[model samples]
Target: MLDVGSGTGALTRVLRAEAAGDVVAVDADPKLLDHVEGPTVVGDAFRLPFPEDTFDLVICQALLINLPEPVDALREFARVSRDGVAVIEPDNGSVTVDSTVGGESALAGQAREHYLAGVDTDVTLGSDAESILADAGLDSIEVTRYDHDRTISPPYDEADVESARRKASGDGLATDRETMLDGGLTADGYDSLRQRWRQMGRDVIEQMAERTYERTETVPFYVAVGQV
Candidate 1:
């Protein structure tokens, strides 16, 4: 199995335990490679280093959208795997929050726009795993949807808040000028944002904990598996 963009080897570790064959994990980040236990290589996904038809399966998670050229990357994945490829990515089209309590600040709005652009790709490709695999020439594709929820509470740390902020304030996605500080969400503004974010978080948690906001489409995870 070839695990492309295997960050921190999380998926790699899981696959290692589940699959009997050798697992070769690859990523561009050297720091992430350091934590991996088995065979690991630092390389680009667009241009994989291995020879053609080197593995029985190639698996990727949360990787396609990040690439500059997703189609090319898909073709590369096809080139390396002889038998099949399994891909798992967030269904960006399914991304939604019940409310924008803060009235969509520039940073936040931009975040949404950035996400929309990438999601457009997913939408164009059917916004599911089946489309991605089929488009990449994989056959007998199967897609599975999973509900993934993340709840944030008080004592909210900067890292957690920032990650959420970044996701909300997608890369150059927002058009508003005021919310964005010189084109980016600065470290300083994060604390103030956190206070506001915490209020929203607490509201949702309280409402949901009280069984008020039921079955809200806040987060969703999707998986697609198929043969090459």
Candidate 2:
């Protein structure tokens, strides 16, 4: 099995432990390749550094959303794999957030709009990967959905601790300017958005201090499969 874009080898580690194969991790970042447990290669998704029909399975997780043309990457995967190709990607548009705070969900919705608008890639093509595979000229295509739930409530964890620190300094909110601009937001629009995000983060901090805020965020992901 070949794992492309194997950043930090997160999925590569899983495949190595669970699957019976010679798991190979490939990524453009040499720093990330250093952490991979098995064989590692430096490669790009658009043009994998392997001969045609080299591996029985080629896969990637959270890879397609960052790509400008996901099907093009999948075509390369198909070219390198002798038997199968798979992609695990998320549908950012399908995300749902339930919160006890009044405006947090609304604020999140606004931020999401800006993010999707500003980003160059199609970041929400999770369930649509099957169609993308079909377009890539692969046969026996299949897709499966996985809904992930990440909730924040009482007895917060380390991630919550980090969130609290960021809110105190408005760290995360301050970084939105460039992302919004890249996503096509005007300067005035980004200024408005940055203020709103900061206000929302402040409100979250206050609510958390009072031990009254609770949130449940669910993100939908899809596993697209195809035969080469």
Candidate 3:
């Protein structure tokens, strides 16, 4: 099995543990591939460095959503895999957030809408993987959905603390300033939104400090498998 875009070997480790045969980790970054325990290769997803029919199965996680030409990349995956190919991608458009703090969910949704509109790639491609696989000329395609739920509650961790701080500073929105602007958000609109976002972050911090903060986020991921 070949794991494409195996960044930091998180999925690679899981594959190695569960698979019957060997799992080869491949990525564009050599530094990330170095973290894998077994065989690793530095390869691009658009052009896998392997001959046709090289592996029984090829898989990728959270990859297709970031690519502008996902079908082209799937064709490449098909070229290398003799048997089947699987891709796990998230539907960012369908994500949902629930927070005890007032206005957090609305502000997050507003930001996400702008971000999705600004991004070049199809960030919501997970929901359309079936048709994409068909376009790649793969058959026997099957797709399954998985919801990743993230919750924050009483026992706050360091990561949670940092998240609050980032929100309070409006760092998260600032990071995507260019994208948001490109998505048609005016400078004044962005400034107003950021100001509200920062206030919401402060509210989150206060809630956390009082041990009354509660939030839940759900992101749906689709696992599409197709015969090559």
Give the TM-scores of the predictions, in the order they appear.
0.66, 0.92, 0.98
lDDT of 3 by residue, 137-179 (tens): 9999999999999999989999999999999999988999999
lDDT of 1 by residue, 143-227 (tens): 8877666544444456545544543443222333244443355646544554554455554445444544332235566688888
> Which segments of model 3 are wrong by more than 4 Å?
none
Tens digit of per-residue lDDT, candidate 2, span 1-228? 999999999999889889997999999999988887758999999989899999999999998899888888999999999999999999998888888877778877877877777788888999788899999999998899989998888777789867756754657766765776777778887667667666766777788788887888899999988999
Q: In model 2, what lDDT does residue 226 have?
A: 93
By how many angstroms RMSD does model 2 differ from the true structure?
A: 1.7
Per-residue lDDT of 76 in model 1: 92
lDDT scores in order: 0.66, 0.85, 0.94
* Candidate 2 Cα deviation (angstroms), residue 52: 1.4
* TM-score winner between candidates 1 and 2: 2
Give RMSD (Å) of candidate 1 vs. truth: 6.7
Which portions of model 1 show Cα errors greater than 4 Å?
98-126, 153-217
